[model samples]
Target: MNKDQQPVVLGKIGASHGVNGWMKITTYTDSVTGIFDYSPWLLNERGQWREVKVLRWRQQGKGVIASLESVDSREQAQILTNCEIGVLQESMQNLPEGDFYWRDLIGCEVTNTNGYNMGKVDQILETGSNDVLMVKANVKDAFGKRERMIPLVMEQFIKNVDLLEKQILVDWDPDF
Candidate 1:
């Protein structure tokens, strides 16, 4: 989850399509066609890795229905319900400069202008407009810890992102 690292998440599996091995997928990407490009995709079945082939697929409603090569029954497809799909680190395309995939920003460190370490990014939460960074912060006094969510806005609060150092320099204040 380093800032320099790249990972392509194929999104979560939806309901089974038909009696065949085809299943629906809820994609977060702009185009469902992106998923069909990869021949063999890595499926996360409750965090375990399972390789599945995308024999045929099309976008339907808010998701995509894909026919897996070996999946022949609804019951078999049903087993993949809610499974998360991800590509290997080597499968992603090279991004343009200043453009980063969400997976790359998940574990970068966030520091304020005054050198106060805010937190390390735990995950990225997708909103309709933009994505938010979920930061896991350490509590100095309390025994319990807390997480803070900050918006990834451009030129407003974010100052710089040094991927080589795995750090993000923000203009946010600790009081906020």
Candidate 2:
């Protein structure tokens, strides 16, 4: 898929691990090694996208180190530092029932039980207790508040998430 079509960011290339072209990776997946599930990663370099194959990889201390096929030196690995590694949306595995990826929640409109439009999800933050949804206020709800942070607690706060409709129904107080 093209760069614009790529959906999920699996990981990012961090500092070079060693002189032999291995680069430290900071993954956004559930597990550190889960990033390796998809091959032929698309690296976002500047504004262009380049495909790179993972020659080999292994888990390190809480993270992962990988060697790309063409990257065979410390200097080569350095050039890829801070580059985002992503795969096409179709490459992701299907989730089980009641589970959802963070990417799927972003940009979805959030409304209250009374059918009042609250805002659109701008980002999702992971807290010690639970996940928080940061919703950017819409024109209708832009009453001095610019954003809202709602807890993603199923049945408690989050009533329903309709990804197909690009909306999330919540049990929130718009005044709060």
Candidate 3:
């Protein structure tokens, strides 16, 4: 698929709610109802992406249940169980400067302010208090570690982030 048409995974389809093809949803959005903001969801069916229209949805207690325009039977809903939901990457809203999405941070080169090549970012960790960058180091680096978890606190540790360059500069200790 074209890069612009690629869908960004956003949620997962849980078990069928009732006999009317309504299914529970587990979303990755900051707000539960925010998932509804993006319509015509690109649902992954057996690894293939198909667009599904949202008929209606509601919040029950703490969970969300939604019905698709075409799915009107329990069997149809059952077929979608465990399927992931996605939306076009372009559909996501623009984030302000200095706020990078986790997906964009993956594979970015990391360096300390002293020009030490720490490694490339492998993933991010959300530890409630702060988000962390999990950097994977070179196999034979003279440094003592394979992975480093640097907090994403901009005011202190993070010195600069150049998304265009795919690099992150931090005020970190190389030998730590």
Q: Estimate each model's TM-score.
A: 0.83, 0.92, 0.90
Candidate No. with top TM-score: 2
lDDT, residue 24, model 1: 87
Tens-digit lDDT string for candidate 1 (1-176): 34454346768788998787788887766576677665458777765676778878887876679887778999999988988877777776778888777777778998878887888889988787887888787666132447777789867767888788889888876556
Cα error, residue 135 of model 1, in Å, equals 1.7
lDDT of 2 by residue, 1-176 (tens): 65358546888999999899999999988788999998769898996778889999998888889999989899999999999998888788889987899989999999999998888999999897998999999866645668999999999999999989999999999877
Query: Cα lDDT of all candidates, in order?
Result: 0.76, 0.89, 0.88
Candidate 3 residue-wise lDDT, 59-145, digit = tens: 977889999988999999999999999998778889998787788889999999989999999999889899899999977767878
2 against 3, candidate with superior TM-score: 2
Clashing residue pairs found in predicted model 3: none
Model 1 TM-score, 2 decimals: 0.83
lDDT-best of 1 and 2: 2
Worst 10-residue lDDT window for candidate 3 reads 1-10
What TM-score would candidate 2 get against the native?
0.92
**lDDT (0-100) at residue 16 of candidate 1?**
91
